[model samples]
Target: MDECSATKSTSLETLVIQNISNVKELKSKLSEIIKKGKDYEFDVSSCVKTLIKSNDQEIVFLTVEAISELVKCDEKRRTYSQKEIISPILDILQKEITTENAALIKQCFRALGNLCCDCDSSRKIILECGGVPNIINLMKKYFSAHSQLSMYAFKTLLNFAIGGQEFTNAMVDGGVVEMLQMVVIQELEKEEIDEEAVCALLSLLSLINENDTEILYSDEINAGVLKVLTNTADIDVSELCLDILHAQAEHDSVKTLIAKHGGIQVVCSRIEQLMQKFDHGELDADQSDVEAILKQACDLIVIVLTGDEAMHILYNKGLGEVYISMVKWLEHTNYHLITTGVLAIGNFARQDDYCAQMMDDKIYDKLLDLFDVYVSFGVQMQKEHSVLHPIEPGTITKIQHAILSALRNLTVPVANKRIIAAQGRAAPTLLGALLSVEDHHVAYKLLAAIRMLVDGQESVARLLGRHKSALRCVARWGHAGEYAGAAGEAPRLLAWAVKLLTRGPYWHNIVEVDGCISSLVNMLVASHSLMQNEAILALTLLAIETLKNISPSSEHPEFDYEKSFISQLIKSEIGKHVSILVDTNCAKMPVEVAENLLAFLDITSKKNKLALDYKEAKVTESLKKFAESRQDLSEDLKNCITGVIAAISDNGKD
Candidate 1:
């Protein structure tokens, strides 16, 4: 009896029907549900179904508003979308937006906008149901008449666009790009700008451009727009504007215009403000956001700096705090910020005077110090199974490339070269990078920078020769393989090392590296005549140094020819490459190459069995041809060739 006679309570669904059937009662009941949202066990989709059937404006508005409130919860939004609320809600909007039902229309838009915020399916429904042109039209109509309604429209369109390329394209086809430009221009002209409206529109435009890079907004941009974009106090709005401007600046004309409108100064001013906030620890945004703002600012600077007008502006403005900020970013813990800082400063260093100024400020030293950090980090990463603080190896490698690229440009001036080489950090840091960074591009940059650093500076080469691993890396990189430019540059730098160090103890360091001998020999046939000449001379010096080091006497008379440096030199097939160069390009070959080639062959042949190896390589034939064919051959070169032939032929007869 107790089981059959349970306590009576009103079923909420029945109570909902009784209360919500009448229009006035339904409004009040919906308001209560909206107010005490989670307290009610309301069926939102059922209400949506009932409201879609009703023609009464108030009932539809109240129900959709209630649905909007309920769907704000993520789970309910997905449920509502799956229940097919989009087509019905869009139906209500399509019919009522035609009327002057501003209140109902705005409420409907708010509901659709909430649904589309992050719900991809609902967004697809809205797009498929032809909701874009409707929303954009309402946006254009209500932009000035009703600001709130226009904002709702903006939010809805942005949501739809966020669905990705298809939805973004739909909005663009509906002429939303021009409409967004109008909104931005209008906001800029306002006595007090509406930062929210401007931010939303700019964000939508950014999406449009992202989806379709061919769409350019540069023509609509003006001085007022540039001023507002660069001077905004709102961080989000500033970020949006920076993104839009970065896209537009892809066109060179826009870059010139922005720079002419005092773009660099204004942008740098914002960067300086952010930097000030950083220094005081009074951040208006999170740390990453602030750094992102700084990064965007620097990126814009990088692209714009490609223009003459921008460079001129930078030259005049002097980048007071901007320069200081970028230099600070070089030392930041964030590698992205470091890369951006590198790009900006690299662009700045395009001017010789700026390079000198940076050098004076010791900015180059800071870059060198950054390289030193990576060098140590790379070593640690290799030795430890797990690091206490792990960073991606690829990230640091990219930064190395960036830093090397900047250094290459910075060291272009001869005076800067001398100063950088004299600083004593450039040589080791750059050479050490060759071992730490295995990327071919980084190797190329490192080699070029070293080439410039050691162009006229023998001291720098000698300093680099001290890092044995660096020499070994250079030797390996100098081989004829992929990335031939890097290969060529590597030998050029090694040639510098060999030429200058052969007289000193450092020659042993160069000769002992695994591929050093072969790298030098490969250059003898290199297409660059000057490199060939340098190679010949460097090899001759190397041979002289090897013989001097292994010269036999009573004390150390037993020289193991198989284990000697000359043995390794012969194994490189230098005779074969030398024969090819002389036979084909003998007339074009320099007298110095001929002289040094003969000297090198004569020195190597003096060692046991090496002369036989040369004869086996047919070096005797090329040397005899050189002695007979070329009228430009000097008496000294002739004598050298004769001496080498006699040495090899005599050994062959033995």
Candidate 2:
């Protein structure tokens, strides 16, 4: 920075150039220049270029060391890359690699690594120079014999891999995947493992997989390696290994293989061990590192236990302690950790045995408590400008989705359903979640959980239906934009609520709820055929209730069935939506829906005014076109269409 310091730096480089013929002095000056941490001065690059071509291996090695240190800066890396020095260094590497010049070869590896640490262009040059195969060869050659060289080679390849897909593909083409797999298998098969080497190799393999899933999907990881590495005492190796397993878990067969090789026991074991350490504050690694390892382990548990076989192995053989440990995530502030714990419990709740076991453990009550905490915390944050802890909204949405989905899965067992409904907290908690949902995915999960809980449990359905705000919430979700998840799932929930409530003593209360009819009418043309049929069934059920209300047994004469309910259905343009469905989606429309639609039209169009409106709108024409377009119409559907047309014409007669 000063003139004297600049002159001193220049004099040092001049001394290197003056003593260029002396290897010992050159090494000393280069080491001194490296320590100075100077950028790429023209004098430095030019002198290093000349010294790199020396046949003396030590000169080449020291020149490379100088290049490595100089390229530590972004501008220097770019400058040296443009100086055309990488090709010469690579040339020397190719020449020395054949001769067992271990020090020079290792230094060349280090230099190449530093050169391409974050430089994509330099990585391209190295790959173009066939650096990958040479590095893979060195890795293969020295993997079993020279651990240090192998590590440098692995780090260099990892640097190349940081360039992403192109460099990763090169490594794969040059047998890098196979080379790393071999390293893992070989090292794991030995009596004593090199934790660092295996961890590095697994890290490389995990990176490659992350960059190219096609390669990872095709890679057949050794079962023995999976078994040993998963159970390895080394946290780093086990963590990296689980990351690969998590990526490969996308393929069900890979999940099966992992389970068959005892992946569940080992993964859960690691989870339990780390959780115990965390609980006792006896973490052996950095807190963040411990959390990362624990997160990866929990991720594997969430994925690998998705299959029935894995679940069977887990609950049947008693991996219950791991589930207990996962439940402890509730006490942590990390949203991801809490979400993963909830997801794993969801996977475990797939079967009756575990659901019952979890119910007995009061896991359901604890999750409900956690949900209440989020709700109360949210309120507190709104009330107070600052709080002791603040959670991101996105993370809060994720936690909500996970908790709702887990509750949904847990209610799948028939016995658990009754107990959950009997517990009295599920309905209100679920309704609160549904009301608080701002994300479509979370709305979908909450609706699905409510739907699952209300499937055959009439008491729960009526419980959810009793809340008018809950009914309105379901209706809003039914039309929640084009997010097919909530939109498609909401109708089923609404239909169940309506069907159950219409049969209960509160039929009058539900029918008066605003937006309920329009929501069902909108669902009549839902892209999901089942949703359309559900709307039809639910509407028909509501129309049947309206007919009952209009009959002699009608108790609530003060409420106008025609103006309040039927007029709302007509105003919602139910017949128009039905016409569109018949005209556009005829061939794809289910026969049951057609029959049910005709039955619903017949029921709702009982009044002469409604029939006249249907006739004027040519709803009959659309129905005939629908009948003509659908050649696969069932006999029941045909009869229903005829009966509906006749009933409409008769009602329309002046």
For model 2, residues 1-654, the per-residue Cα lDDT tens digits are 887887689678666576667667778877776776545453467677777888776777778878878887887787677436888866655553444577777777888888888999899898778778877876777677777777888888888898898889899899997787678678767788877777777778788888887654443464644765665777777777778888887777777787667676677666667777777988678878887877777677778778777656655533555565567766666666688778877887877777888888888887888777776655555566555547766667777778887888888888888898887878878887666666788789889988999888888877776777888888787777678888778778878777777765555655677777788888877777888888888889878877764542256656776567767776887667877777777778777777788888888677776676677667888888887777898887777887788877888655
Q: Candidate 1, residue 546: CA error in Å?
A: 6.7
Look at candidate 2 and give me any clashing residue pairs.
none
TM-score of structure candidate 1 = 0.67
C-alpha-based local distance difference test score of model 1 = 0.74
lDDT of 1 at 109: 80
Q: What digit string (tens of lDDT, one per residue) describes model 1 on residues 1-654?
A: 253232122244544655555677777877876776534444556556766557887777777777778777776777677435677766655653444577777777888888887889888777778878877776776677777678888888887788889899888788897777677677767788877777777788788878877666646654545766765788888888788778878877778787777776688767767777877988767888987888788788778877656655655545644456667778876666687778767877888888888888887888887877776776777777476547777776777777877888789888998998776778876776677666777788789888878877878878777788888888888884787878888888888777778666676667667787788888888887898888888877777766665544343356432355666766788668877888887677777666667777777787666776778878888878777888987787788788888888887543
- Output the worst ten-in-a-row residue range by lDDT, candidate 2: 216-225
Best by TM-score: 2
Task: In angstroms, give how far residue 226 of model 2 lies from its true place.
Answer: 5.1
What's the lDDT of the predicted structure labeled candidate 2?
A: 0.75
